[model samples]
Target: MTVTTSPLLAVRALTVRYGAAQALRDVTFDLAPNSALAVLGPNGAGKSTLARALSGLVPPVAGSFALDGRDLTGQSPDTIRRAGLVHLPEGRGVFPTLTVMENLRMATACDRRGRAAAVDRAFEIFPVLRERQRQAAGTLSGGEQQMLSLARALMVDPRLVIADELSLGLAPRMVDVVFESLRRARAAGVAVIMIEQFASRALDFADRCLVLQRGRIAWSGDADRAGPELLRRYLGEATAA
Candidate 1:
């Protein structure tokens, strides 16, 4: 006998517009559990828009998306998040005035009973956070801050994390550290959609690659084969850092 497994996410013809400017044009893809999909594009390619639309921050002008086989289109952001889709937007989304511990505590507001376990799990995943638990979140280095941001996101027990430009303004070493955290997340069976500027690193980390151009899917295929010329053409930037 054979058993079948379904995809963790399914998006079909996802379309979004900002006033008269179409942001996403019939974008569609499927992501399986434990998979990593790297989204690459030039500026104004509508990468961030796609993430916002999926998380319900921006309503789609047309199309549909689902999580774990459940239709999630038109759902509220909070409702979709509670159902296990988490969006980690660009920047270190931590409370600067709050201590690392306090920031993590905020993530557990919806699950008081799991607070302790969640904090422990976060520390276990990123031990550096544990060492700086009492320090102000704003006092950490860029890499450390990114770690805290990821740890806080995991507290909600999300099934998929859409990371948008996570490596934005960090040093080369810090980028390595941040990507390692993402690697660990994938190893633990959390699917990831990485919108990244470092095309080479992103392609190496993800198995599948989707290149967007002018709010449309310009190409989609195996990451290993996404040539540099193609990146230069569609990505509009050199593939190498």
Candidate 2:
């Protein structure tokens, strides 16, 4: 006998458009609880558009999405976020002008109870943020800023985190740091959808992979099956693994 668990997140026939141009057409996938999926494609493949649509930043022209059996199609971003679906966009989503401590504090604004504990937990995850808590976020190094950005997930207690371009422009060492942060989130039973241009490491980290081409799913399968050959075939030289 086999037992089957429902997917933590489900996207079915998701289509998006900008005016008459279709950005995504019938994109579909499923993610189990606490698992990770990587979205890989060349430039203009609608990777970020998929992230935006899932997080309610872009309204989909057709199809539906659900988290934990709750339909989230066409809901507002805030509504989706509060429902434990968090989108960490490409820019890290940190308030540049605010101090590191101030930014973490901002993440706790929704709930008044035990806010200090939330900040402390964030500090525990990224002690570098603690050491430079008083420093302005804009002045921090790219890696440090990304640390501050990921801390919001801890403060808000997310179930499914959509991280787009997490390792965009940083030193190689910093890329390791960013990936470790993602590991910690998955360890805490949070699902992750990583939309990455740099494919090698992300492909290794994810349990599954979804490939998009011209806004449609070109390939979808286990991450181990997504290699240089597939990348070269679909992405050309744009995202060579």
Each prediction's TM-score against the native? 0.97, 0.97
Over 4 Å off in model 1, which ranges? 1-4, 237-241
Q: Please list the residue runs of candidate 2 whose C-alpha ends up more than 4 Å from where it truly belongs after superposition.
A: none
Residue-level error in angstroms, candidate 1, position 14: 0.4
lDDT of 1 at 74: 89
- What clash count does candidate 2 reach? 0
Candidate 1 global CA lDDT score: 0.91
lDDT of 2 at 95: 88
Q: Write the per-residue lDDT of candidate 2 for residues 1-241, one digit (tens) a residue.
A: 9999999999999999999999999999999999999998888999999999999999999999999999999999999999999999998688889999889888888886968989888888788898999999999988888888998776788899998998889899888888998888888778999998788788899999999999999999999998788889998976775
lDDT of each: 0.91, 0.90
- Residue pairs clashing in model 1 are none
